[model samples]
Target: MSNDTFTSWENLVKKQLKTDDINAVLRKENLEGIDVKPFYTDVQQPLVNLPKIEESTHLVAKYHESLEEDVFAFLLNENVENLEQKTIFVNNVDLAGHISPKEEVQYFSLIDVFDEKNATVNDQLVKELLAKQFKRNICIDIALHQNSGASISQQLGIALAKAKELTEIYGTEILEKLIFKLAVGGNYFFEMAKIRAFKILFNQLSKEFNLNLTPYIFAETSLRNKSVSDSENNLIRSTLELAAAMIGGADAVYSNNYQIGNSTDNSEEISFKQQIVLAYESIINVFEDASNGSYYVEDITKQIAEKSWTYFVETEENGGYLELLKQGNIQKDIFDHAIEEQKWVEEGKIKLIGVNLYPKLEVKKSVEELYNNTEIKPVRWAEMFE
Candidate 1:
């Protein structure tokens, strides 16, 4: 619509609503330090695309090697010009047994050093990695912070802090292969903004380090959105989460099995196939930066970056992430956030589908039978209400 027509229409709406100023009436504030306007016009100021790269580079990256053989072979079948698409994420502890110079494979991988729920790289693994470079490229993952309810800004700041720590302890050489594995929560555009904000933060840090490096992001679906009782609904949640990751410029996407901390062959097959369908059948790869030029998305991305930068500076002033971790401030802060979130679920503020709404009568009736009577480990978000 023309600017003049938009102005006229806005005037009519303002009169109907009995408000003289539309911006004041319709705007709302968000956690990301931005205002949510009721409407949008053409760009008021110049804004750049998040990664500044073409869409082809952002095409869905790779698959989980843990999938059943026949299922994961889809990775081998999708031919491409380069060897990078063949890459997959692997645990650092498992690298020694799984790969060696003897194998004729080129895999781009994020060598997981620390996962808060499980383990970190031990002294021996660190020693082995320092001894010599392996065949596959490696990147360290800091996905645990997000899972624990840290804000997007905290995640970005902590990542840089951890990278610096690892660089000092391991070696700056590892940065050459560094990749960031991020867990995308169900925030849609905010999650998209998280990634773009990350790229911007890393780019600024790289300049400080005199390295012109960009991170290859591996996106994992969040554990927050998965529902145990309505297990079948996870595929739907995962599909949308995967789309957000790809459209946000994830080099690769990984979907978790619907059952939390439990992935059987069946779940693996389903998750892998779903990703294939999204990329190929659904054509998520057809566009480059699909969210680019979107007014709301672009604005949100900018706000996330700005807020995250402030967090980064505060983290540095507070003596980096390790110190904050030792003081238990980081964990406590996230825990407080989780407690607040739990209250929301309890109060019915959040719509968690089968967990809180639209549950089948049979499932509700069989809760005692189908559900585990024992304590659930690493509690689900909806556990308080359920």
Candidate 2:
């Protein structure tokens, strides 16, 4: 529609709502403070011309030593082809004894040295590891950011800052095999735009260093919105989250178990099957850029990128990510947001089904303890309500 036609429609909306400001009646604010209008004609500003992303996402499953063969057997039984192409995220680095010689699966190690969930960074350990020129993927796991209640822009900015700090400490060689593990939340469109926006911001950061780097983003479902009592609803939540990750153009996707804390026996298989159904049956992986021409998503992506870039710049000026973490700035911001969101849930402002609204009579409270004395901690929002 033309700008003139848009103005006419705005006038009609204003009259219907009986308000002078059309935005006041129709616009909504997202968690990142971005304005979500009811409709869009065209993008006001195009930030970055996004390149064509891959049509298919690589499936990533957690590796267990005992159930290694069983996992493969299950996949094969389900007609999952190309076993070699699948990625395995394992906590153990010593895969020599575990994996079969015939299998050619890729492994993403979760070494504590690089994991943000480890809380404190052992500088000497990191230097020692980097000196050996770690060949495996050096994960910058900002997935904890979302699980800790960080906003979308916060995640992007923090990821960029973390990458910058690592490059400065360990040199640019680390960027070659760096993997960004992000947590995909339940907000369908916003979560999709978050991944797209991060790519733009990361590219901009790379340009500042005179290097062209394509990020390998591994998207997983967030634990923040998951509830122990209402575990059944978690399945539906994770499916949408996985869909968001694939549509957002993640290099890899891992759907976490819907059952909270090993409550169900086949939770791992259930999670893996979620990916299988989305990839094969639903055929969501067919599109190169599913949300490419979407005006709403495009606008949200640009806004996130711009805001995140500004946050990154400010962060760099203030001694980067680690320095801020040591000063408790990063942790404080995330903790404050976490508390605020929990309060919203408590007051019934945020309707997390089966938590604040329509809760079960015999719901069990989460054993996941809250940490008040940590740097940047992981938290679940439903913990408060339960």
Candidate 3:
């Protein structure tokens, strides 16, 4: 439709609708506390300019000159011999500590295992794998549960610090060649902003370390907001959440399908296909960085970057990300945020669809059952580490 035609239609709708009453609908708040406005005009826009399409050189500079030797150099130069030639073992910690040869797994995730005792082991395993493996990616969740109110700054700092340490231990050149995956949460705009900001931050860090590699982002739907009572609705929520991830330029995304509150079969084909359909059927990737030019998105991206930068500087002042984490400062912040969130739910300030506001009927799947049934295991070193 032409701009004038769209504007006329909007005007007609505005005239027919009671402008005053429109506030009631627009002012409605979502679970995330994002306020909706009855109307938006260019006049109410923030004075922020759209984020500049960062120079392509900024990205090109992150990779080694050798990796850019050909059109498919990145893929061809990735050491696949290391991945296929390695033998991995799986040690079942939950069971009688039985060890089995590691079979190739389709997906992997890295989470809370950053103690001094384990850090060395983790680093060794990562180094070994990178030397041998070709097509594998490392999933790292340094930001998970670190703080409240979307601490992207802290997350980025922690991630970069870890990456730095890894590079020092296992040649910066190889570390640059590896992909680092991250976990993303439910704060739609904030999460999207975090990923975009991270790309810039990672590029900056790579330059400082003289490591050339573009950071790869893999986003998963957050587990924190999944509801057990009305679990099906979680699918709809994830659809929107994943859309934000795609718009933010995530290379890969996984939408959680199991009932957050109850345990179901892990092999849910339908849930996996949701992402497939989105990528292939919907063809969302056709328009690269679709949100790049949006006024609101650009504004939010800058806000996220500024907020994250402040947090990162604070982390440095506190002797860096790992130092604060070891002191439990990170945990304290997350606990505080959780407490505030719980209070908001109790006070009816945040209306979770099936939990806080419109509760479900006598549901078969309860939240407790979901947590109890799913045995979440950390990514095993033997599985991916050579």
User: TM per model?
Assistant: 0.79, 0.82, 0.63
Segments in model 1 whose C-alpha atoms lie over 4 Å from true places: 1-3, 11-33, 50-85, 101-104, 108-111, 115-124, 130-138, 261-264, 286-288, 359-379
The digit string of per-residue lDDT tens for model 2 on 1-386 reads: 98899889888888889999876667665557887888887876654445433346766565534445534322121222345544455444343224342335554534434544443565764554444322345677888888988888888999998888878877777776577889999889999899889888877778778887667777889998898777878999999999998888887788778898874547887887788899889887666567887899998888888888888888899988877887778887777676676666566766678877885223234323553534466777677655
Kindly list the per-residue Cα lDDT of model 1 for residues 1-386, writing each as its tens digit: 69899989998989988999878877864444466678867555645655533334332323435533423222332332323323334443454444443234334445555433322334565565544344335555656666655667767777777676666667776665567878888778888777777777777777777786666677778876676667777778877888888788776677767665567777766776677788778777445467888888787777777877777777678876666666556666566555555555555565687776785212222223322312112335655444
Taken over the whole model, the C-alpha lDDT of each candidate is 0.62, 0.71, 0.48
Q: Residues 287-312, candidate 3, lDDT per residue (tens digit)?
A: 44656655555555666556555666
- Which has the greatest TM-score? 2
Alpha-carbon error at 292 in model 2, in Å? 1.1
Better of 1 and 3 by TM-score: 1
lDDT of 3 at 253: 59
The C-alpha local distance difference test score for the whole of candidate 1 amounts to 0.62
RMSD of each: 6.1, 4.9, 10.5
By the TM-score metric, which is better: model 1 or model 2? 2
The model with the greater lDDT, 1 or 3, is 1
Tell me how far the alpha carbon of residue 49 in candidate 2 is from the true structure, in angstroms, after superposition. Answer: 5.9
